[model samples]
Target: MPTALTAAYILHTLFAGVWVGAVLLATWKVVPLAKGGDLGPDALRSIESGLTTLTRLAAVVFVATGGHMAATVYGSEGLFGTGRGHLVLTMLTLWFVMTALVEVGGRRMRSALDVGKVRTAARDADAFLKAASVAGLVLLVIGGYLAGPAV
Candidate 1:
């Protein structure tokens, strides 16, 4: 049981970290560099491709591991009645919103690129992703605070 719990915990943390890191990189570095022409179209495309894949994978992991932990570990928190439960619920809500933003932005980017609207798509996607990044960052801070050592 302990081993299983440990594995789940590690996977959860790993994916969360990846999600945050990818968003931070996209929000801080990729956006500015790409906009200023410091990064080429190919580079921007490549970065977007990779980050989108990673973020999607991380979301899947988060859902699975988070659900599992919530069921097995924090199941007794009163399911949104208590403070911890409320925090978890809030994090989950933010996660859903972030996921939707990424999905919509990704689809828009793909459609724009298909129509040769590369610049427009990139700009639009950047805005959407930046919003998602901020949402993820807020979720990260809240989750960390909720799961702090003191907790």
Candidate 2:
């Protein structure tokens, strides 16, 4: 049977992949399409809807799996036990904050988009998405370190 830590690692990796993959798709494909005028109003609306759906889904997975991983790895001692635990805690906290920001900012952007305020919504949404991407990358690095062979 897999150890708790092993299970946690697997769950964390899965959520991290989802988060990172979504961010990459948005940045490398979606944004460029929007910029090149290939994504007009209807297209933008559709994209925004898709983004909102995916982000929310990913955030749910992130939070649930993250909490489970933390509990499994750290137990009641929490994250103060070791260097690796500390790194994981930090990354998790950052992910939570960034996810909250994205939720709020994305909602605002959607509202703005609904009112035909394309430019403003696009700007804010882009900023939120970028922040999310950065946070996701940081978490990925920290998670990789944690999963690496212990020093």
Candidate 3:
């Protein structure tokens, strides 16, 4: 493979790592603390802001590098045809869904939080966030499997 393609692959991997890692950390550490009353509303809001920044930055990098890599390597048919391609497509779809969930949920949570109703909006949505986290892990596992010597 060309040096440029290799670099793109590495970047794409790193961006995915950023996204998946942030989500996992939020689900495991932050969310639980907020839900368990260890963190107050202001703390949760601070976390939300920081997480939002990371999520948006990672999303841009992930999409740009992933699109470039997919186009350079497999193009359209390969993306839609093969098993590995299917995993990529699934990741893209799940990424979209999770992003939308975060965007919408964040907005709603922020609105409620603005009115001092943090627990209802944020903690209640932990279930959805948990599911998204599990889906993220699944995506990582599939990507790792595809990255094996077979592919």
Candidate 4:
């Protein structure tokens, strides 16, 4: 592989890890704390802000690097017809789903947190965040499948 493409792959992998890890952390840890009133409004808002920023950054990087890889490796004709192309498409769909989930959930949580309703914020955001977490995990699985057998 070319150096540029290799670099793209490396960046793509790193961002994917970060993005998914954040989602999982929010779902498994942050939400529970908020629901239990263990976290303050300021802290929750900060976390939500951080997650939003990370999600936005990851989305841009994923689109740029994934698009470059698809164009370079699959080309126009290969994307629609190949198995790998289909996996890429699946990943793209999941990416959108995860992003949207986070945005919607974060907005809901933030609004309630602004009012000092920690439990309400957690309740409102819980389902969306959980779904996003599941989608993120699925994306990783699909990514591994696309990677094929390791050498």
Best candidate according to TM-score:
4
Candidate no. 1 TM-score: 0.85
Q: How many residue pairs clash in each candidate?
A: 0, 0, 0, 0
lDDT for each residue of candidate 1 in 21-103, tens digit (9 for 90 to 100): 88778777876765565666666667778877987888788878888888876785555567788888888899888888877
Off by over 4 Å in 3: none
TM-score, candidate number 3: 0.87
lDDT of each: 0.77, 0.72, 0.76, 0.92
Q: Rank the candidates by lDDT, best first.
A: 4, 1, 3, 2
Query: What is the TM-score of each predicted model, taking all chains together?
Result: 0.85, 0.80, 0.87, 0.95
Which candidate gets the maximum lDDT versus the true structure? 4
Model 2 steric clash total: 0
For 71-132, candidate 3 gives per-residue lDDT tens digits of 98778999998887887898888888777666665666677678877666567657667776
Residue-level lDDT of model 4, residues 1-151, one tens digit each, is 6698899889999999999999999999999999999998888899999999999999899989999998988887778887778788889998999999999999999889878898999989999999999999999998888777623
lDDT of 2 by residue, 1-151 (tens): 9976666667668867876777667756776666565666677777667766776887777677777877776765657788777887798698787677667656866787778766666666777777777887887888787777879
